[model samples]
Target: MGLVELAFSDWIGTITLNNPKKLNALSEELIKDFCDALEELKRQSVRVVILRAPAGSKIFSAGHDMRELPLDGRDPLTYTDPLRLAVRTIEYFPAPIIAMVEGSVWGGACELVLSCDIIIAAEDVTFAITPAKIGVPYNISGVQNLIITGGTHICKEMLFAAQPFPVKRLVDAEIVNRAVPIDQLETVAQTLAEQISKNSPLVISLLKEEIRLLSTSHNLSPETFERVQSMRRSVYDSDDYQEGIKAFFEKRPPIFKGK
Candidate 1:
């Protein structure tokens, strides 16, 4: 059996972290499977995605594979190495992504959820980041994501406290979008994905790019701005734009070519 599983239907692709026996702690094979699944979703032009785990787990993920930690329990830089690319993939994926989380989410697991465009958690879910307690500095990318989702103060608390909090508090802090009953987590996540999938694909892709530019454009050099301008020009000249306008005039939904 694979560490991760992916399935698609009706323009929505779902990825499940399947190691429920280990609380779905991400492993080496899981990382590869996840990236491969994302690539497949891109190829299929999946309009939306929902990430979740199989039901009846005591936790969503307990963090890294602690058994692989050094005997002296040193914080291994390699532990976070895979996440750099995985988080980047999550951030730059063309369509919106959502995380459906129940039970406990810790360390890298929290970082994973933060990378998603939206997070819907079970009301009883617990969240934490344990790197600080383990003598590891939070990875810079993960810290940036925490800041983006929860702001500076909450980010500091999560890292400094090194303790888990109920998912509702996270929702209150805007770190998570929805907190539904445990049984309703999948329903809510799927409903949100369906809503996103119903949009114009061209607009969804363009807005994702535009927002990504806006998020990272701060403190950029003039050359960077110029490069961004080039990207903007390219988007304007895309064949999808022509199709979109044609569809508008013809009173029909546009079939975006992603060109």
Candidate 2:
């Protein structure tokens, strides 16, 4: 069976992550399937898209598949990376993509939710950015998404602490559009999608593009861009990066030393 399942009706296309056993880890193959699904939905002229998991799941996503991560000192999140591309696809998708989150979102998956046009989550939902926990250097664009959605202070707390932010906090920070009861999550998400689907697709598309452009409009000087890359490179090239991946596979806490 495929890792992603797609259903379309009433101009609303729903994409479900079907790999529950793996906690819907965003593997390369899964991400490719997701991207393809999005393209197909666009071709079909779906006015709205809802990205979700099966009902009653305890995890929306565990984030990137750790086993697929490169442990050989190579950058794991280059612009051409599958997960990065998938996030970009979500960001640039013509219609609104609603993330119907019912469980904890971690790692790159947290970035995925933030990339969506809107997020309607269960009251018990939580979000955590775990790059620090695994010594991964998050890219500038990803960091910008977090900052745009939750502000600089919230982004710093999540990245620095590598802890879960509860639904109340997420809503308070304006990261979640709506926080409903667990059982009402699907209802709320579906209702919103239906309402959005009834709107003018062209207007929504243009507005989404405008917002995407403005949100990501910041430019950096050549020297500053190089400096940012160097800072991220330092993390990925460090012994801490190696230790973090090792500890994850070894099921132990990594002891990171400033190198």
* Predictions in order: lDDT: 0.76, 0.90
lDDT per residue as tens, model 2, 122-217: 998889899999888888877877898889998999999999989888888788888999989888999999999999999999999999888878
Which prediction has the highest lDDT against the true structure? 2
Task: Return the top candidate by TM-score.
Answer: 2
For candidate 1, lDDT tens digit of each residue in 163-214?
A: 9978888888988898988878788888888989999988998998898778
> Which stretches in model 2 have alpha-carbon errors above 4 Å?
none
Look at candidate 1 and tell me the lDDT of residue 207: 92
Deviation in Å, model 2, residue 108 alpha carbon: 0.6
